[model samples]
Target chain A: MHTLHVELGERSYPIYIGRDLLNDPQLLGAHLTGSQVVVVTNETVSPLYLDRLLAILGERALVTEVILPDGEQFKNLETLNQIFDRMMHDRHNRSTTMIALGGGVVGDITGFAAACYQRGVNFIQVPTTLLSQVDSSVGGKTAVNHPLGKNMIGAFYQPQAVLIDINTLHTLSPREFAAGLAEVVKYGLICDLPFYRWLQEQTPRLLAREEAALAEAIERSCSSKAAVVAADEREGALRAILNLGHTFGHAIETAQGYGKWLHGEAVAVGMLMAMELSARRGWIEPAEVVAFRDLLRVINLPVAPPADMTPGQYLDLMGRDKKVIDGRLRLVLLRGMGEACIVDDATEEELVSLLETFR
Target chain B: MHTLHVELGERSYPIYIGRDLLNDPQLLGAHLTGSQVVVVTNETVSPLYLDRLLAILGERALVTEVILPDGEQFKNLETLNQIFDRMMHDRHNRSTTMIALGGGVVGDITGFAAACYQRGVNFIQVPTTLLSQVDSSVGGKTAVNHPLGKNMIGAFYQPQAVLIDINTLHTLSPREFAAGLAEVVKYGLICDLPFYRWLQEQTPRLLAREEAALAEAIERSCSSKAAVVAADEREGALRAILNLGHTFGHAIETAQGYGKWLHGEAVAVGMLMAMELSARRGWIEPAEVVAFRDLLRVINLPVAPPADMTPGQYLDLMGRDKKVIDGRLRLVLLRGMGEACIVDDATEEELVSLLETFR
Candidate 1:
């Protein structure tokens, strides 16, 4: 097992990564301080892994279950209310604990639920999928999607701990696994060129879900995320670069309706858009864009954005993204193949030019 | 104008207490960091003072308004969502600021909204009524009530500044004015013996809306609230003492239906119950109870719990209050006038005795 600490003062918690750690009683038990626990999982994850986690929890606390529907579409105020309803129904107090047991959607919603439940509660993230384990699980960025923008209504709440059982990746569909790689590739593009090279070289091992390579990817991705989050936990300046493709990607998710395209799939296309924009501005060579696109394609991630969006549609949607500072659209665009920077200087005309080329 | 600073490390804000300060743009403008603002008010306060506040904002930023229905009954998640819906509808982003333009219900709801909107946004509390200016305005405790308890669903979010316009208090009905005095009296009973005596002597002046007495009352109450909040912003321990009558008060509000009795009115009766409990426990002399009850009666505040609720109902409801620690009800009962202490050792037998005697 590998343990990484997110250094957030008193709210700092550990991310425990290993095979079958969900069944490891010590890792799960060490963090929970309260006797009342609510395990929030989705229908899909509940069917697969709930029993394993429940067994690990044993008789440590009075555990209740709030099983939400599986998908991004269910991430809304209504679903969030359901969690609160359960919390109130179970008579859970401020000292009660909540465990999030699913991928990013479940984790995001549950984390926000914990953040708001009785002002705040101790929440542990038990991320099952690669997307959540590598990205959402480590960062305390918990939010649900709004119709206008993704994660528009949320809080920057840290969890008590994150328990990652990378063994759960065995259950992920191939498409789902690749969806998580988009964020992994994002780390390489933003801050770690060496990791990008490593990703390129280890594509076969990552695709095969080899233990060592997958573990390395998850750890490296988390380390980079933790370092950035530690520097700017609230995304003041440097952390905005982490949203390398998220502004366009969140727009894609918002415009298409949440459940239609997986978050990573949208991000994959969005990263390509970012790369294309970078190349247009002569920040990176055109060949780097091709190579990046090829790597994404090789990993079975979507390389092309949805064909239906007009530059006007993209403009309208992206303009409303959370990254817009003082009403200016601040996007994370590449300065070079391995360096990303927040670019707010791009005009609508420039965006249209890039969109026209892409289409 | 009297400006009292809440001494939280990074979250500290100033409370500007005086008559007609809402018209002072410099007071409001100096605290605001962004050019986008959203003013959230109730239907009750909108017709009275919303325009004056918007005028003070004065083309400084793009201002949007969300006018909600008034009353504690409306302080719920559904109504809170209306604020979010307007925020999304207006395309307000993280940098957009929110000004709460009403009493405690408005301040609590808007503060929670600002806390949750895009994780958080800068908010200002423009408290019109005496209660909010004295209590909610100084403390960063913001919440919307749940059906189960009062202020159950919310966050501990501070504002950029609190703008108090005592002139707006003239618009309050006599019953509402007295309701606000209930919390004012609580500050006196909790920690300030001199203020408690002042409240008793100045009830007539307070009821008459004498500017000098009202301003002094607001300033003194705010100072007490600020001191407690600065010490324990998240209600770890010391802050719980400020919730002296609240555990019982929350029960009364939840049981009798919100808006039936204003928060301070419910708290007025709850405070008497605490005194009665203190007397029964031999913590204070019986003379203190009679003196406390007389002052409340003179101020037009209730000194009795609801005749409809049994002791069991009170117990059931109080048990669900946020002040309950590890399933134990920790109540703020008086050690004597202006000296409050948290008591967890009160037996059900003693509570039943006190409830029966009061009944």
Candidate 2:
């Protein structure tokens, strides 16, 4: 078992990663401070893990279960209200602790629910997918999607703890597992060169679902995220680097309609676009773009934007992204293999020309 | 103008109280950091003050006005979505500042909107009603009512500055003016005996809308609230005392329907019930209760719960208030004229008897 602590002063908490940690009652009990608990999971995850969690909680605390329908499209204010309605209906008070037991959608919405439930309450994350375990569950960025944009309505609320059980990854579909790898590669591309090289060398082991390789990957990703969050909790400066492909990724997600394309898949294509733009600006060699593209291809991730999406549509959708400040779009472009920088000097003409290259 | 600072560390802000302070551009501009602004107001207030505010803003910044329907009944998540829809439709970015230009409903929904819009944005409160000026606009508590409860969904998001224009009180109806006085008297009853005595002496001046009396009353009320908030920002311990009559007050608001009873009016009757229970517990002399009741009667505030409400209804509704912890109801009762304490030991049987007496 490996544990990483996110240092946020009073809001600080730990990330527990290992095999079958969900079955460990002692680990879960240490953080369940209240006499009542509300476990928010989705239909997909509930059928698999709800009873196991209930068994661990066991007669000690009054428990309420809310099972939402699964998918990114369900991550909206309407679904968020369902959690609120169920908790309020069952008389969950301010002292109740909420446990999010699914992937990114479940984690984001539940964490946000905890933040707004009676002003605020304690919440723990039990991520059941690779994308969530590596990125979404670590930082306190909790939000739901809006029709106009992705993650347009949300809060930066930290969780009490994050429990990651590697065994859960065994249940993930191959496509979903590869999608999560998009984010895992992101950490190395943004800040950690050695980790990137390590990922390149251990691709076979990682692909085989070897326990040691997966645990190390999860630990390294969370460590990188925790350090960045501690330094800039609200994304004032350094933290914005973490959203290297997210601005473009969000544009794809919003334009394509949420749930149609998995978040990791959009981000996978978005990262390639960022690298291509970075090459055009002479910030990085074009060879690096090909190298990253080759790695993504081998990992079974998408390397190009959808054929139907045009430059005009990309420009229009990207304009409304959260990264736009004072009418200027800020893009997180790669300066090198292990470096990312926020650039706002990219003009619309340049963006159009860049998008035209994909055609 | 009288300026009071709410000491909340980095989140601290100033509360400016005086007659017609809303017209002061320098005060408003000093806090507005961005060149884009969104002014959220209601139909009732837009025709009255929105144009005047726009004149002060001039053509320096791009402004988007969102006019919502008036009344507490509209203070729900559905109405909150209207603000989000308008902001997104207009392409308002994170750099835009939100200005709430109406009463408590506008301030609250706007504040919560600011708190959630792209994680958060800057917001200023221009409170046009006495009720908002004295209470909701000062505290960071921002929320919308749910179907089951009042203020069931919200956040503790502070504003950049609170602009209180006492002159707006001149346009308030007699009933609305009296509702505002309920909160003013609350400050005196919970922590300021001298202020209570002064209010008693200046009743006629206050009722007559004398500018001096109104300014002094607002200053005192904000000072008391700011002090309590600074001591405990999240209602941990010291701040909970500030909800002196809110537990019972929220119950009445939820049971009777939101717009049916103004918040302060419900709180006025709730305070009397609290005093009755306080006297029954031997915490204060019964004469003090009568004295306070007589004062409320003369001031034109409601002195009893709604005649149609039953004891069973009170228990059922109050049990769901935000003040409840682990299924135990916590009520803030007066220990004396100027001292308030949180008590959780009050029996349900005693509460039933207390409600019967009111009937």
Candidate 3:
């Protein structure tokens, strides 16, 4: 078992990574400070893990389960209200602890629900997907999708702890597993060169679901993210770098309609676009962009945006992105491998020309 | 102008109380650090002061107006979504400042909207009613009501600054003005006995809307609230005292349906109930409770729960209050005049007897 602490002063919490950690009642029970507990999971995940989590939390004075419909499309205010309705109906108070047990959608919505329920309460994250275990669960960025944009409404609320059981990866479909790799690759592209090289060499082992390699990747990804979040709890400046492919990815997610494409899949294509644009601006070498594209291809992730999506559509959707400031679109572009920079100077013409090349 | 600073370290903000503070562009503009501004006001206040506010913010790069319908009935997630829709429609970024220009409902919904929009942005409180000036606008308690309970969904998000213009109170209906004074009197009952006495002597001037008396009441009320909030920002311990009458008050509002009973009016009655309960428990004098009820009656505030509400209904509704901990109802009861304490040991039988007496 490996534990990494996100050093956020009073808000600091640990990320526990290992196999069968979910079976350990003590590990899960330590974070449950209140007598009552609300386990928020989606339908798909509930069938697999809800009973196990409940059995572990069996001795609690009260335990309520809210099983939401699974998918990103359900990650909106309407669905968020469902959790609120159930919790309020059951009379969950300020002292109740909420445990989010599912993928990113479940984690994001539940974390947000915890953030707003009675003006914030304690919540824990038991991320069951690789994408969530590596990205959403560690960063404290909890949100729901809006028709206007992805993650348009949310809060930067941290969790009491994040429990990552590598065994859950065995249940992931091949496509979902590949999608999670996109974020694992992102950690390399954004800030860690040695890890990028290590990921390149260990790609086969990672894809094969090797426990040692998976644990290493999860630990490194969480460490990099935790450091960035500790430095900039709110995305004021340094933290914006974490949204390297998110602005473009949110555009793809919003334009394609949420749940149509997996978030990691859209982010994969978005990261390639960011790299391509960086190459055009001479910030990164074109060959390196090509190499990254090949890696994504080998990993079975999308290397380009949706075929029917136009440069104009991208511009329109991206304009409403949270990254846009004062009518200017802020794109997180790669300055070089293992480096990312927020650039608001990218003109519409440059973006259009870059999108045209995809045709 | 008298300014009271709510010392919250980095989140500290000043409450500017005086006549015509809204007319001062520099005061309003000083806190707006963004190029774009969104002024959220209700229809009742829009026609009265929105144009004046827009004139003051005319020089901004972009100014958008979102005018919602009036009343607390509109203070819900559906109405909150309207602000998000307008902000997103206008492409307001994280840097855009949201100015809430109305009474408590508008300030709360707008503040919660600001807290959630793109995971929060800067917002200013331009409270147009006496209720907001002394209470809602000063503290960072921002929320919208849920059907099951009032303020069930919300955040503890502070504003950039609070601008209280006493002149707006002159336009308030007599009942509304009285509702606002209920909170002013609350400050006396929970914390300051001297302020309570002063309110008793100056009730006539306060009722007449004399500027000096109103200003003094507003200043003293805000000072009391600010001191409480500074000690406990998230209502962890010290701040629960500030909700002395709120748990019962919320029950009254929820029972009567929002907007039917003004928050302050319900709180006025709730305060008396708490006082009566305290007296019954030998915590306060029965004579003092009558004295408090007399003061409320003279001020035109409701001094009793809705005649239709039963003791059982109060128990059921109060069970869902945010103050409930581990299935225990934590009521903020008075130990004596000018002193408040949270008590969870009050028996259901004792409560029923207390409610039966109201009959």
Q: Pick the candidate with the highest lDDT.
A: 3
- Alpha carbon deviation, residue B287, candidate 1 (Å): 0.9
Q: Write the per-residue lDDT of candidate 3 for residues A1-359, one digit (tens) a residue.
A: 99999999999999999999889999988888889999999888988898888988858787889999989999999999989999888889999999999999999999999999999999999999999999999978999977898888999899999999999999988888888999999989999989998988899998999999999999999999999999999988888888878877888888888999999999998898899999999998999988998899889998878899899998998888888887888888888889989998998889999999985
- Report the TM-score of candidate 1, chain A only: 0.98
| Tens-digit lDDT track of model 1 for B1-51 | 888999999889888888779778888889778889999998888998988
For B210-252, candidate 3 gives per-residue lDDT tens digits of 9999999999999999999999899888899988788889999
Prediction 1 TM-score vs. true: 0.99
Please give the RMSD of candidate 2 to the true structure.
Answer: 1.0
The DockQ-based CAPRI class assigned to model 2 is high
Q: Where in model 1 is the C-alpha error above 4 Å?
A: none
> Model 1, A1-359: lDDT tens per residue?
99999998987888888888977888888887878899999988998999999988868546789999999999998999999988887788999889999999999999999988889988999999899988888779988887778888889999989888888999998988999999898999999999999999998999999999999999999999999999899989998888988887887888889989999999988899999988989899999889998999899988777888788888998877888778899989999878899988999899998888766
| Greater-lDDT candidate between 2 and 3 | 3
Q: Which ten residues in a row have the lowest lDDT in candidate 1 chain A?
A: A55-64
Pairs of residues at least 3 apart in sequence or in different chains that clash in candidate 1: none
| Regions of model 3 farther than 4 Å from truth | none
Per-prediction TM-score: 0.99, 0.99, 0.99
User: Regarding DockQ, does 1 or 3 come out ahead?
Assistant: 3
Write candidate 2's Cα lDDT for B130-154 as tens digits: 8899999987999998878888888
Clashing pairs in 3: none
Compute the lDDT of residue B249 as modeled in candidate 2: 86
